[model samples]
Target: MTNDFSPLSQWQLDRARRTVHRGGVIAYPTEGVWGLGCDPWNPDAVEEILELKQRPAHKGLILVAASTDQIEFLLAPLDPEMRERATRHWPGPVTCLLPDPEDRVPFLVKGDHSAIAVRVSDHPVVKALCEAAGQPLVSTSCNPAGRPPARHGWQVRRYFGQGQVHIVPGALGGNRKPSRILDIVTGQWLR
Candidate 1:
């Protein structure tokens, strides 16, 4: 399948933001592959992503933000050392599991976990989308459970079908692997 959603333009970004604001899901380029995203605060939107990917709710989802400020609530509780360790790899392909005090993240996004997985994206499209959305977004690989993540827009459409998700056209970053997951408290690599 061929994709019309390439070389992301400002108009496409606006459309994607509108779709997200209306509680719709979208597919956009990430550091390594296409990712499905939605407003993290919207349960319906999050559920749509899970349904489209056939992902179990217990697995949770990763949240991507444009800047650390967008997720300060989740990061504020960490001590200085843990906070530094958690944020040392920001704006890159690294996801950190941090303690969620006050539980600002919804249970669906956090799943059954006490910590939330988050990343401050360095990819321009992802950063712009999060900035346009004005908050963190729920991000998961753009494919069903057990399937390889979509590497291109057409693959995203083939997996979820056109019109099911707003396709935000862009190129993946240079990373060849998904973001490495690290637990801030244990200094362990979860991925």
Candidate 2:
């Protein structure tokens, strides 16, 4: 699907990218709401996300990529049919739980599970951020646990406050609900 969502200026995107690379968190627009993102490979950054959201480490997190190639490591272990089924929903709001072989994903991001939740976003700003960061980002709704996700830049600031999260100004991509999560192995709908 074409991303008709509002765009962020080059400087804003650059700063957000830098923040992620430096192990800092960023708040950016997603398909349904604002999301907090950090480098998935950076354990410190993931810890910050967990602390900010008041979320437990065992709950796991979602990773958002700009393209399927960014998550090839996680997809390499799936069978052909299962891989095809999962990749077909890419560049959209569908989050698929796929097998994580070799434990490539960090324990904090995968939690206690052998599967990791992932999505290739169609949101323009998110795609840009991921491209700039050169990998998929650890993404979670931009709010404390049990609270509503932020839908606007102002709300992100309100929730995280200044200096807490670098807000990447943009608009949501018109998805009314959070992405539908499915387990590729069992064909189960998780959300």
Candidate 3:
């Protein structure tokens, strides 16, 4: 069967966005390597991601954005200093855990903590995706535990072998490394 998620020469981005609209998980480039993502607000979409990765919801997931403001819906009481630091790393790879309110942040994406991991991504397509979705998207590497994360769409398709992530072909950012995870409160390394 032909894959509807194939990367068309021009409408790839729109197709990916539509795929998300249809409650599908997707693979696209990130700051370092390719990442799998879906609408964080869509429970069905989120469930797909969890099932695809065999990830536990209690473990939580990271949300990547084009801007910090995109995460305002999930954040609460961001301190002045920490906000500044987060701003300094935004539009780039640096995931920061920020204060979150239970009412605003959903339990499916939050770990056993009061903080929510958020990233202001440096990837252009990621930024556009968030802008298109009008909110943060669940972002995670496109691989299972103990396996290397896929660096390209072909690798993603090869790993999942089809019908996995709705593939969106594009080049990854030049970083060649994953984002650094930081604790917004203690400035501690969690990753």
- Point out the higher-scoring one by TM-score: 1 or 2: 2
Off by over 4 Å in 1: 1-7
* C-alpha local distance difference test of each model: 0.89, 0.89, 0.76
**Model 1 over residues 1-191: C-alpha lDDT tens digits?**
11322456778878989999999999999888999999989999999999999988888999999999999998878899999997889978899998887888999899999999999988888889998889999999999988999998889988988689998877888778879999999999989
lDDT by residue for model 3 over 1-191, one digit each (tens)?
11223224436767788888888998887767788898877888888887777788889888888786887654436667877766776767788888785546677777576887889876677777777767788898888766798887777888787787787766677776667888877988777
Better candidate by TM-score, 2 or 3? 2
Off by over 4 Å in 2: 1-4
> What TM-score fits each model?
0.94, 0.95, 0.87
Clashes (N, CA, C under 3 Å) per candidate: 0, 0, 0
lDDT of 2 by residue, 1-191 (tens): 34566677788777888899889999888888889999988999999999999999998999999999999998888899899889988878999998987999999999989899999988888889999999999899999988899887888888888999888877788789879998999988889
Q: How close is each model in CA RMSD to the real structure?
A: 3.4, 1.3, 5.1
Identify the runs in model 3 with alpha carbons over 4 angstroms from their true place.
Answer: 1-10, 74-76
Q: After superposition, how far is residue 134 of candidate 3 from its true place, in Å?
A: 1.9
| Global local distance difference test of model 1 | 0.89
Cα lDDT, model 3, residue 41? 74
